[model samples]
Every structure is written in structure tokens, then in C-alpha cells.
Target: MNERQRARRPGGRSARVGAEVHQAVTDLISERGYGNFTVGEVAARAGVADSSIYRRWGSLANLLTDVALTRLNARSPMPDTGSLAGDLRTYAANVAREITGPDGLAVVRLAVALSSMGQQGVQARDDLLAERTRQLQSMLDRARERGEHAPDAFAVLDHIMAPMYIRVLLGIGPLTPEYVDGLVDRLL
Candidate 1:
């Protein structure tokens, strides 16, 4: 296996290290821009030796990418609420909770900054988008099966999620249940 894959093998560093280090990285990135942070600083804050982090993530950029993406995926899977509007409201509420929380807000800020940097940041941005889209798609699939949704499933799903994220990225407002319900109504 390739080195990266080998390092991610079960019981390898990936399996042993819990979310603590990731949380620390998120905090540091939020307080100090990713461009200003160093792995040594992250290691010290996370209470791990620098070598420990280096062995797992290789570089600050890679570490940041993994930290942001991993945390987003760590949220609970979207709920199946039986109706498209109901399911999307639940999904939106869940996302709103996460994105407005301290860790989630920090991760979103870092992601927005990274995304604005163009090609250099495209892969990580794309990976985060794809992962979140997959989660939203699962909810959309359930809605479609229940006959609560119309055609253009992808657009419908995007219409609900994209605005929530845009607000988070722009610091326009907190994602509230009221907002989630509003978006669901418009999308449905």
C-alpha cells in the first residue's frame, strides 16, 4: 500500500488519535489564520509531540484539510423525517446547529479563507463540498422515495443547503431553526 494509505490503516495513527487534536487545530486556526499557524504550535496546544502530528498529517496544509473535513463528517447523519420539507428542516436544523457552534464556525471560517485562495485550495474545498453534498443527497434520496419531492433533486437539495452555508461564510447570521424552516418552505 502507499504510504498515506498505510498510515491510515486501522490501529495506525489515524485510528488511535481521537478528535482532541483536531479540535485544537480548529481553535488555533480560528484564532490565528492558517497562514500564520505552525505544526509545532498545533502540537504544543494539542499536547502531542510534533513528531506525532508530522507522522500522521505530513504538513500544516494537509493537517488543516483533514481536521476541517473530518470534523464536518463527524456530525450525525441527516435524519429521515418522511416528508421533504420535514426532512430538509431537520437537516437544515442539524447543519445550523453545527455551523453556528464554536468548532463548526471556526472550521467554516478556515474553509472560506482556503477556498478564496483559488487552485491552491481547490482540492480541499472540493472534498469538503462533495462530502457535505453526499450527506445532503442522502436526505434528498429519502425525500424522493417518499414522493415528497419534485424533479431536479440536486437543485432542490442545493437550494436548501447553499444559502445556509453562504450565511455562515459571510457572517450574516446565526443558523436558527426558524431559518431552517424558512429555507425548507422555499425549497419545497
Candidate 2:
């Protein structure tokens, strides 16, 4: 197989059992919702000793964090559309498509449900939000550099792009090309 596949069963003393355990937990989460899950169950599912999981992740929350973020936090490389509207629409559609998928929906649901109690929760949410905002901001900055957008247009940028999440969460509309075209027309 490839290098990533090879890494699946790393050959050394420090090879991670965490990887296998996390995959098992991911499968279980797909089978069973996060709320109705347990560490013992994950251990059983992973076929690894419970201590191995605890040793790697320290707690269920940590394990779930790794499972959720590691799987869903892969941001694709941004495309250079040569114009603000084209780039933003492409980016938004790409992100919406990715995040609205089965795994992405699962991660969002899990994050919303659990990321609120402690330091880890706050950090996790902050990290996600910051990453998202940074992506949008980078696109906006690039657009400005190419003279496709106004230099001081953060407000307009937010106004146009903020609805992406609303569409996903409220299920108010499809993220269709026609819809993206409309958004581009209004914002750009």
C-alpha cells in the first residue's frame, strides 16, 4: 500500500495503538451516536485492551476529540479562481459540500453537543471557528489583492458568506450552483 496505509501499522516500539482504537471508535460512532457510547464499548470494538486507549487518550472526551477532529479537520487546498466571486463561491461550495457530508455532519453534531463545558471544549470550538474564519479571510484578502473586491469589505464578506452555515444548520435551502450564483451576485 501507500505510505499512509503503511503508517497504519507502524513498525516500532512507539507505534500507536491509538490509531486502531480511534478507527474502531469512529466506526462505533457511525453505528451508535456519541451520547449512547462508552469506553468499554470502544475497547471491545477496537479489540485492544482498555488500558491502551486510556493510556493514549487519557479520557473519553480526549478520545472523542481526536476521533472527531482528526477525521473532519482536513481542510482542502484553496483554489485560485482569479476573481473574488468565483473563488469565494468555489470555496464556499467546497466547504459546504465537505461539512454537510455524513462524517462532517457527525462531527458538527458532536462538536455542538459537547464542546461547551471545559477548557478542552472551548479550545476545540475556538480552533474550528478560527480555522473557518481564517479560510474565508484568506480568500477575501486574495480577492482584494487581485482587485476583484473592495479593499475594506469585511462586513460585506461576512454578510454574504455567513449564510452558508445557516443553510446547513437550518436546512433552509440547497447549496446548489444556482444558489451559489445568487450569493455571488448579491455579494460581489
Per lDDT, the best of the predicted structures is 1
Candidate 1, residues 131-178, lDDT tens digits: the string is: 767776777777667766543546755776678777887888867677
lDDT of 1: 0.70
Q: What value does the lDDT take at residue 173 in candidate 1?
A: 88
Consecutive 10-residue window with the lowest summed lDDT within model 2: 148-157
Query: What TM-score, computed on C-alpha atoms, does each candidate reach?
Result: 0.72, 0.64
Native RMSD of candidate 1 (Å): 3.6
Q: For candidate 2, write residues 70-188 as lDDT tens digits.
A: 65445544567888767766766676677566654665677765564477556655665566557667777887777664433455446555566667777766778777677667765
Q: Cα deviation in Å at residue 31, candidate 2?
A: 1.9
Which pairs clash (backbone N, Cα, C closer than 3 Å) in model 1? none
| Candidate 2: stretches off by over 4 Å | 1-19, 47-66, 73-77, 99-104, 144-162
